[model samples]
Target: MQCLYFDQDVTSGTLTIDDPELAGENLFDVSSQRKRYIRNHKYGMVYQNPVKGLRMDFSSISNIAEKQIAAGGRHVGNMQSAGERLLDVVSIPLFRMKEEPRNFSGGMQQRVQIAKALSNDPPILFLDEVTTGLDLSVQAAVIDLIKQIQRDLGISMIVVSHDLAVIRMLADRTLVMLNGRVIESGLTDQILEDPNHAYTQQLVYSLL
Candidate 1:
């Protein structure tokens, strides 16, 4: 198996990916302008904290519209329509579309974050510990929503989470990591049923 490594410099807030196959080259080698273009136009990210991904004071509709606008949407009517549609898609009531996310529950804030991420209609979505800090029932609901979105949108998603149950629910391929190294990877069921590495076995057994 080919292993990909990510090193982040906490002090500088810089992240480097050391995977040739994944990037086809060093991602950081690209010009800053090109990187910005790719980030704005090609990728969507949902942070673990809704506060990181959202403007807490902005109305949910404005939050969605902000992304659309960033992606070059100019027509007010079109942006409004798209924002409303995305809000509906994420299961937020149309009546509450104008409410600030800060006033909503944890689950609702995450849903708004998801809506905003999808506003750009990017082909790839990256979710980072998206269910953390939510109740079990809320986590399950968010996971279900993610699955439904995947089915309906048919977009590629990279989900990062420490929860084994969340991995089992969302992933077809699994990569087991230990101390920032990918120790094992394969089809999710294969790994779960017959983990080769000792650590992987322990994880699988613990899930039982």
Candidate 2:
């Protein structure tokens, strides 16, 4: 993250991933600002690579609780109890709440991400190929979890993926993008069963 003055001048930069920032208030300030933005938006990105994306050092519960804190909700101040509750909500045992994310299995880490996203209590959740790395059983569980969350919170979703099966399962509405343009879009079942565009038809057929 880069810190800039209100006048658009670069004030400082913090690269937490890089070895260059051994000790710096600049990065903390910038990351804080980013966290604030994420909290306000109530949207999250569940990246495809768990190893590369999630904070390996932060306990899964802490990661979720931090977002809740940034969102100005009733979560940050009571982390000890709230964090455990969140892990439970995501189906993680209370024992795992204190463990670092690297200790979790792939599916578990993804659940951690979901729990974290919901911590902010956002009205929408955008999942990018959420089930790509999971086994079939885990994929179904994850999909069911998303549906249940939507029902419970009345949240909307925009699931970005190239997999037709995944889109069919998750999206009420479907959109087909090609070279930056939306080639087809509508009710998911409609797009799947009776596509209007040739590209969409091709896509559906290929899925068969």
Cα-based TM-score, every candidate: 0.87, 0.76
Worst 10 residues of 1 by lDDT: 1-10
lDDT of 2 by residue, 1-208 (tens): 0111111234344433222322343434555565456434445556566754467899887787667666665644576666677677778888788789898887888888877776666655667678897899998888888887777778767687778888877788988887756798889998899998988888889878
lDDT of 1 by residue, 104-204 (tens): 99999999999999998877778889999999999989999999989999877888887878988898898898996689999988988899999999987
Cα lDDT for residue 184, candidate 2: 86
Candidate 2 Cα deviation (angstroms), residue 54:
2.3
Clash list (residue pairs), candidate 2:
none
lDDT score for candidate 2 against the true structure: 0.70
Off by over 4 Å in 1: 1-25
Model 1 error, position 152 (Å):
0.9
Candidate 2 segments exceeding 4 Å error: 1-41, 73-77
How close to the true structure is residue 158 of candidate 1, measured as C-alpha lDDT?
Answer: 80
